[model samples]
Target: MKVMVQPVVRLLLSVPLCVLVACGSGQEPSPKQTLPLLPKDEVLLAADSSKRAMIVEQVLGFELAPVMESVAGKIAYDETVTARISAPVTGRIVSPLPALGSKVNGGDPLVELDSPELGKAKQGYANALADARLAQGAYERAKSLFEHGVLPHKELQEAENALTHARDDVSQGLMHLHNLGVEDEKIDNRYWVRSPIAGVITERHVNPGLEVRPDLAEPLFVVSDLSRLWVYMNVFEKDIGLIHVGTEVSVTVVAYPNEHFPAVVEYIDKLVDEQTRSIRVRCRILNAQGQLLPAMFASVDVRSGPENKAVVIPLTALFTEGEGDQVFVKLGDGHYKQREVKVRLRMKDRAVIAEGLEAGETIVTEGALLLRTEEANEQSEIDAP
Candidate 1:
């Protein structure tokens, strides 16, 4: 009995010791433990607080119709100083074509042509001159005969009439040769096409040995003074009243966007385009550096002048709420309130505030929609059950 009791006691003690050892080994923790909790994102002025920084505000200010009428324009050669040269008569182009971009003075020969039409003109002139000389000598002889009563009055009268007709023919022929660009000293079939204005040859469509005509659809050469250019912009009929001759404007081209070229309204078309319902306005640009090229698309800003001053804001700031125009006015830190405003004129990327806005007031220029969303959310939460 004692031996049995001793064995049971030893088993009981070893079991407790085993339990203690198991607990101590388990203290070395498993690999998949619970991670620490991260702090919550701070609540900004909006639901997505991170986007609150994107909301921008600007103080209202009065400007000369800050909403400039921006329109698409195209750069073109100033017609006042541009020339399109074509063949004066039917001809075949000779050697030595006009160099593209080469500067030329008025009356400078661009290309020489070998023309059969020119030859006929010169021949006709020569024939008329010979007939005139013969007619003059014949009239002198007939007059001498009549004065001596040797020739009949009718015959002398006929001779005088013949001389007059011959002289008239010579005059007409000489005029025709001059029109063909034939010099009196050098009458030939070689016609030299000359430039009528001083300019650089901007374009050339003629090549050696090519036949040219007077009524070619496209000119053979386009000579333009690149130092000055014109910008043609179309203004809507509603805006035409604000623009007129001498109105100052700003111009920008894709190649030089950072530079604002100053220009003035030179001419406004008398009639509005029936299709576009817009009047064409031409502005003169002085491109002394030759940076601007013809046919380049440009942006033109026609200021409203000092007479149309008003508070202006970016178009992004103006939002439609109900039937009225609204904008977000920043009152305090991270707080914006919507205000109904009256828009006098809306233009590209901007608007003129006629009422409900004042100078020096801070208004949201961007991200107004975000503020509106935040406001709607707050109101929704308030009405939640």
Candidate 2:
């Protein structure tokens, strides 16, 4: 998974040039009119742009928690078992092919290899063992005769040398037999290549009578263990700082929206993607029902809580300016300045500021975004978007 960022902006702006009437129109403005219409509570904001209602002042700090209090995520597996069991010796497949997804245990006959090379190796090993045994007997007799001065020392040495060569031949022949898949006890008969793991055969490329060569990529079978899986997701580089190894994670796939699986954060990429600017994260999930499959699209939510109080601005205050985020604050005495602020959390639509704001300051929470939009349009290139 990789992280990506796309900025979203919603703003409206207009200019309102207040006319000084010297309080002569004193019929009095409505309370709603005097207070200004916006979204938040305990807030008052003057529109620097058009008088159209856009911003709202409110008390922030709220969480959108479901009554169930559970996070939804998708399924994932980390360790995937894949192997192409090739013939170690040129051979003919003598066993029927295992069906795809067939379960196998260790030492189970996946298929038997009957090769001319195997028969030759077995015959050679038997002959070498016989020759070595006979040579050993002659060597022992000759050494005894030499010790009794009944035979020449050179003749005895020749017998011993013959025995040594025979022993070497025997050892090499046994190794060749082993390489041909002849277990020591089965060196006398042809045998099968059994499963190396307790898993299912995911692929079978060869069947009975299929002539396979040692030089060929000749795959006989493929196996995989699906008892557990891995789920991966991407986090924005800005959010990566909060994630750590062993963090609890939950995932839910689109195919199974009602079920959420649990997993532990196993790995978080150290580097951010150059194009997406997101960090990759991986979590290992154990399958209790063996339900997850490969390449399934999933949604993962990482729990990042322990909330803290932060300066929040009115949602109405932020106006989309080109591709940037901007907010207007009522600085003082009817003057409002558009400022840059990074939003962190949102409570009841009030955006908690991650940066660019101080505590207890009056910000144009309602209609501020519109005001900023109007300013940017009026100032055009003069103001940063």
Candidate 3:
């Protein structure tokens, strides 16, 4: 009886002793026992009261905004207002040519040329005028003689025919001079090369004493009205159906990144480029202040169709992760989840989300980075061995 009672007492004493040894041992706590468990997509910040106060929350909503398609483009001169000024008649440039960028009015003299052809024309005109006067006097005299029976009728008729021929020669010479831009009062060997339209001389191709002709391949000057410009864009074939002749467009240039110029779609190419599979689009822009320039790189946004309903949020609410964008949404008090969202349109200070978000949901606009940082720290602790 004594032996059985002693063995039971020893077993009871050994159980409490093993429990005390395990509790008193110096060992690190297991992460599963110490760290708070959270859903893979969710994070909790209730432990940090300061972090909760730093976060800003907002509800998503929709707005009416024009649907737009963005494409790369470049600035070009408006062809209607551009002109290549060339000499109308073949001659040497005698007058001082206007300096490049000189503003000129219609008929403004760009060059004065001394041409041998002009001189000969002037001489011929003078000779023809003299002959016409003499012939007219002779015809009048002959008519009077024929009527008074002083001259034969056949001789008077011959004089009248000669007068008609002389008059024709005179008129032909005068027409030639007029075609050469020679004024009747200023008939001379010198011909002034004048601008046909009012604009600034954008290019100069001739110098004083340089011979120029009407058929020269290169122009003597290029005049363009810089008050307006054209932006040329290439649109994908798929987007061509959405564009039209009178759609509104917005343009931006690298030189002026912060500014956007409003424009209108003026032309669309009927043919598609075979290599790029794209269509050419042109937009007319008003540059009353002449701030835009030709050949500058530009970005174009064509306003397509009508406004549509979309989920929109402030731009600040977005955060980038991996190759896509992300945002944080509140699940409950001090609980948030990171979500991947697709941004459709980015405006001045807001963004339109095409996916991964819904209206009336609360998202963290401010202190999003803080939440991300906290999540990273918690992950590190849980992952430590």
Candidate 4:
């Protein structure tokens, strides 16, 4: 009888356990569903208008900004003001060469050459002068005789023709000597290499007793006016159209990185370099202080177009997203929108906007990354279950 009672008790306990399980199952909660976050082009800031003002700064608009193109360049001599001093006649260098960096005046003798050819030319000139004098005397005597009816008119005319021919010979010989740098009053065998322009001797290749020739590949001296300089820039073919004569340019050199030299575009090559596919542009710069030197590496900024009103902003305000550049613009209150902008030019600390921005729109100068971080957090939260 006791065993039968134990079995009935166990059955009652099992039935109660099944009813408890059913009740617990009915009270279970369903999985929570979340809403999607804001789109990538937008973000909502947690800060209010007043707080945002403290965190970031904004400007209403910008004035006209110059559009510029930067290119690598090198400083060079202004060819218009530069001279390559070479031996005018084939000879040996007789005099001491002008020291490098020496200031010279126009027509100052820099190198004296003892040229046998020059000596011969002088001798020929002297002989021609003597012949001319003899011819003139004969012509004068013939004219006088003809006037007194002592000589025939035809004879006097022949004498005049001879005199003219002799004078022409004398002129030709004297011109030859003059071309050799021989003075009329001081005709000598030595040929003086004179500076064509007043400048400093930038280079010297000749020494005393060195043989130099008119056709020498290397110049004896290079004289340049250091008061002016030239910068040669390799402008891309696409930007060649913007570079024209008289365009304003600013140049910076490694020696004076903080200083910007003012210059003007003086020339542009008609042909493009086949290897670089770039056109050569030349800019003339004033070097009154003589600080700029040739062969110095330089950075050239060529002002392409006229100054126009553009949406300019600090470079710090820009952010890169994948292949595009973006900036956060304050919409109103605590809202911000990520805008894709066309960067026309990027300076050291400023950016010139070409599109996707207007004059009156306010931008986030600071706390932009905070807004972006908020956007990412929202996305992650929406993805979480």
Candidate 5:
């Protein structure tokens, strides 16, 4: 039981199909048909916004900041023991080191040595002194005779020369004994070695009866005056000019972060190290609690340069597109241009410009990322169509 369609209904379906076929074959559109399009300015704005602001990449040109006014440095011992002290002559140690870490006066006994060589030096000095006394008397008698014309001038001169030689021998012999640790009063085998300077003993080399020699396998003792110390720091080639003598600076030690010691620049190296490309700056620090130690890894900062306005820009403004750096600056009115700038260095959150933008110029810190992206996209579009 199927229903049959009328002939007029069949004719209406064929007419609608013929219209659809005519439209698909690119026939002109009807009078009311028109293409839709966005306005040119709106299109530009849309395209620019589509490039999108980079994830809130904020940028702003900061006011000219004053050059840094202050800095810091470190403290250390003014002198250092580069080479350890060794026994001058071979000897047998008699007494132990004189009270480790004791503040000793100059010429104080540091250690005592027992050696037959020391005794021999003392005997030689005594013999030389006796000879000098004999020579002096002979010279005096010869001078008197010469004045009276009984002895010749040459004979008196010989006597004087002999006395002089004897005296020199005695002095040399005494010094030799002294070097061997022989003190003036004690004439026994053991001799006392006097300290060279007033300081604390840092190291002890030998014990009693141990043979000491000039060999520097280990130091006998290290003595240093801890009251004053030096802090040495390396300044990079660019930062070296900031360091200068008499500049007061601060030092912070890794060991004591809570405390920052005040120090002054004592020395600035004239030469830069070839390997590290750094110059050494020496700072003098007063060790109040004797807390500062040598090679303790301290940080130093020195205040440098006169206060002046430095042209700066936001770090995000630098677009390293190719070989050069570039930024967009808003000229007077709505005009903006892609500008190339030379960055001096990174400053805090911004960058210093050695060239390019001037102080009064307004730069497009914000929306720069979007502008670059738009420019790149437009270039691609023009090349495509």
Candidate 6:
């Protein structure tokens, strides 16, 4: 009884499987799709054709603005507000070097140096003052003696000349001391290197005992007003015509990828580099938040002159036929015309039309190639007669 029951169950399962296979094999195949009909330069979609296969949109006017993109640039301090602090006299740096990133005023001391040059200048000035005082007394005595005929005119004249020379020496000595930044009150050789501008100290190269000189290759300190900065870009000659002194620009940096810094063209080189055919373009940007730093590499986009209005279309909507450009212009009721067009410019994803198109006209933006294929097939069939 058990063997008979197993055979019946197997038979029932096998019968259902055979029925399913038969049902699938007997079904009719889907009907072949029919393409749109073409008449000369026009295409007419079949009644059963799905309209969603292609995207259609009204043509609109777009302003064509000249732009220089992805230009390599660098951030720098504005020279007008930046000062490179260096020692005027040779000396060993004393204690308390100006801290990096410290805010300072114009006259704030940055470094103190003890130099023999300062001491010598001070001594020379003091000696010159003493000599001038003695010469004045002698000149007065000589004048009195000359008036009373006790001294000869030649002797008085000689004394006057000596006095004049002495006064001149005093003036020279005083000027020297002032040039060394040594005040009259300080008798020692303590020379303080002060900042010439009110800004934050962005650099430092001095230690407590490091020797410094006036001709050091690098300045001991760099103080700059971080509120403004300069950006330098190298622009090639082909695009230089579009840029001018007042052109607007936008800058981006790797460190701050999402932020856009606005800038204006401040300077442009008159001479182009013979080898590179490039010129230096300088721009100024306001950095009130101190987000940009000197030496940071940046990408700059130069937004040149005013833009011209023109009709533009998506690149997908444009089709090439032999040597000319063409697009499918919709003429209502699933009818489209393949019209020749002249492209003024080919951008990344759009084409600027110079002729054969107008604003407010409907055009095929996505399926231009479909119409092109249909027209070709129809032409072949008609020629086969």
Winning candidate number (TM-score): 3
Per-residue lDDT of 256 in model 6: 91
What would the TM-score be for candidate 3 when compared with the true structure? Answer: 0.71
For candidate 1, lDDT tens digit of each residue in 170-246? Answer: 99998887776677535577888999899999999988999999999999999999999999999998888877899
**Tens-place lDDT digits, model 4, residues 1-385:** 4366888899999998999998888956888874436676677655443445544757648655646556889999988889998877889988876679999999998878888878788888888889999999999999999999999999999999999999999999988877766776455677788999999999888778999888988899999999999999998988787668998888999899899998999889889999999999898999999999999999987654455567779888888888888888877767788888899889876788988888788888877777787778777776678
Q: Count the backbone clashes (under 3 Å) in each candidate.
A: 0, 29, 0, 0, 15, 0
In model 1, the Cα lDDT at residue 272 comes to 87
lDDT by residue for model 2 over 1-385, one digit each (tens)? Answer: 8644333221112112122354455687666423333332112234463464444544434332211122323444344554557777777777677788888886677877777777777888888999999999999999999999999999998999999999999999988766665776444435577776677776677756988776776567766677777777877777676668987666777767789777778888888899988878888887768777766877665554435445545565665665756776665544567667776654343465677777666666666645555554445433335
lDDT of 5 at 151: 99
What tens-digit string does per-residue lDDT give for candidate 3 at 21-102? Answer: 9888968877645657776666788665788888999988765444554688988889898989777777887777678879
lDDT of 4: 0.83
Q: What is the lDDT of residue 71 in candidate 2?
A: 30
Better model by TM-score: candidate 2 vs candidate 5: 2
- Cα lDDT tens digits for candidate 5, 1-385: 8666688789988998999998889967679643233222111224344443432232334443423322234444456522235667667887766767688777677777776766677778888888999999999999999999999999999999999999999889888866655557355566666676777776676777888777758878767787778887777787666556887666778789879687887888889999988778887888868788766777654533435346767677777867988887654333346778787666444677777877566776667767666556555555564
In model 5, the runs with Cα more than 4 Å from the true position are 1-76, 80-86, 140-160, 175-186, 215-218, 304-385
What is the Cα-based TM-score of model 5?
Answer: 0.55
Candidates ranked by TM-score = 3, 1, 4, 6, 2, 5
Backbone clashes in candidate 4 total: 0
Cα miss at 234, model 5 (Å)?
1.3
Whole-model lDDT for model 5 versus the true structure?
0.68
Task: Give the per-residue Cα lDDT of candidate 1 at 199.
Answer: 90
Model 1, residue pairs in steric clash: none
Give the TM-score (vs. native) of candidate 4.
Answer: 0.70
Pick the winner on TM-score between candidates 2 and 6.
Answer: 6
- RMSD each, Å: 8.0, 20.1, 8.8, 9.5, 11.3, 9.1
